[model samples]
Target: MTTSDDEEINPVTMLLLDQKDDDVSQPNNNSNIINIAEVVVPTAVEHQSYHLNSITSTLVIRQLPSQGLSFQLWPAATTFVKLLDSYTPSNTDPFSLTVTNAVTSVNCRQRLRILELGSGTGVVGIAASAILGADVTVTDLPHVLPNIEFNADVNKNVVGTRGGGVHVAALSWGKVEEMEGVGREYDMVIGSDVVYHDHLYEPLIQTLKYLLLGDGDGERVFLMAHLRRWKKESGFFKKAKKWFKVDVVHEDGPSGKSRTGVVVYRFARKDAVFR
Candidate 1:
């Protein structure tokens, strides 16, 4: 959903969440009934022309990628692409580089298990494994996995030629029951440009809590990149802080208009001593 920069409310956000679920006739959880309207305005950058261009000519693109972008954005069986004819290759994917920097700064080990949520094109996770040598598992919805797999398949070749591990799977963050006992918790969890809708905030947080490793050698750190929008209130970050010590470790902009172009958040489980 979108609005003119000056508008106080975004009708698009409300409309995006208003449609009834297609599976409504089937039995479902009551919690699923909550639509996007219940939450405050969503804070996310509209991808615009450049972000899509990053992958437009790469290989595959989605017809209507999840981001709020135009028809020039290509939708595909897996990865989405849009032409970035104007932007330099370095600026083509701002979010991807942000995640890469976070993983590198943390000194993630190549041998550790790593998980990535909403790995749209699998860029960050794959790059991390390639650079750090970590065994990576890239995940998204079942529908999104095939494309992630394709990306992983390509990365695996790059890494194997260089000696690294890359894997892909289907993961819906809030579906904890399905994800239980999959394996040991990951040492690092990475997400890029993922938080947008207010309705998904609680569920996304809950899912992270469930998957995080809290003890032993399995420490977990979650890093996310976002382009701040009005609906993305500080309160939302505060709400997440209750579960983990949240910090806006990095911020940069012209992501679009007056809004910050890219922001990096690092979160770790809060300790009692610190509190």
Candidate 2:
């Protein structure tokens, strides 16, 4: 089915929209579905370690790469980890342009509550918890929770030493009950490559609205690391901008043959973004 320019598919009411099951799962030219890695490790379990130079510790995460995209590491996730690892109370260059004051406030409190959507392997959330000494809840599909829990377990000591913690939960986007279960008590929301597919745009935006636009006291921000892979992705941003004032906080220039740079965006409510 051909989609008109003005048509915005309601991701919650209709997930597949006009596309059939097979077509929806098929590899379109700009589809974000990636499944090309072939791992030969034991039971196809791969372990990735992130060294936090600031804290002088390492966080180890397990990945089920054979399972699919949700089980492996992505480019944007690594970017977020590096940014968070470099983040400090005095040097907040990563969050310099956008939400700087809010981040500083949270850092001063040392009680930053973070909720990570689509936590996947849980590396980004786990790293944030340890680096900022914040309590973080990393969530994803129910089926994907085991791995996230595993990673959180392995890093308990690392985060515990820093006075931070990690919690694993299941949060499927666009699900009202699930979103309610996750709650909106977070000072910051984070994700990496969460804007890949077109169908996921509206639902993800719905959840973002529920978190960022609702009645809140302090500054609420969504810091997302994204690697722009397709021109069609502009529509998602266009739709998101209506409910949020998005800004580029940090940009990772392309290296080697990698032409696309990973960008970290800070999404805040229209009023909160300025304040």
Best by TM-score: 2
Estimate the lDDT of model 1.
0.50
Those runs of model 1 whose alpha carbons end farther than 4 Å from true positions after fitting are 1-110, 233-235, 255-258, 272-275
- Most lDDT-accurate candidate: 2
Kindly list the per-residue Cα lDDT of model 2 for residues 1-275, writing each as its tens digit: 55455444222222111222221122122112434476434446656667788788888767665577788777678778877777655664647434356555564646878899998899899988888778999999999999889889988988886799999989989999999998998878999978877899999999999999887543788999887665678889999999898988899887433455788998888876352
State the lDDT of candidate 1 residue by residue for 160-246, as single tens digits.
533558787777667766466344356667776456566778777877777653465234567676555555455568788887877
Distance from true location, Cα of 197 in model 1, Å = 1.5
Q: Would you list the C-alpha lDDT of every candidate in the order shown? A: 0.50, 0.76
Residue 22, candidate 1: Cα error in Å is 42
Residue-level error in angstroms, candidate 1, position 50: 14
> How far is each candidate from the true structure, as Cα RMSD in Å?
12.4, 9.9
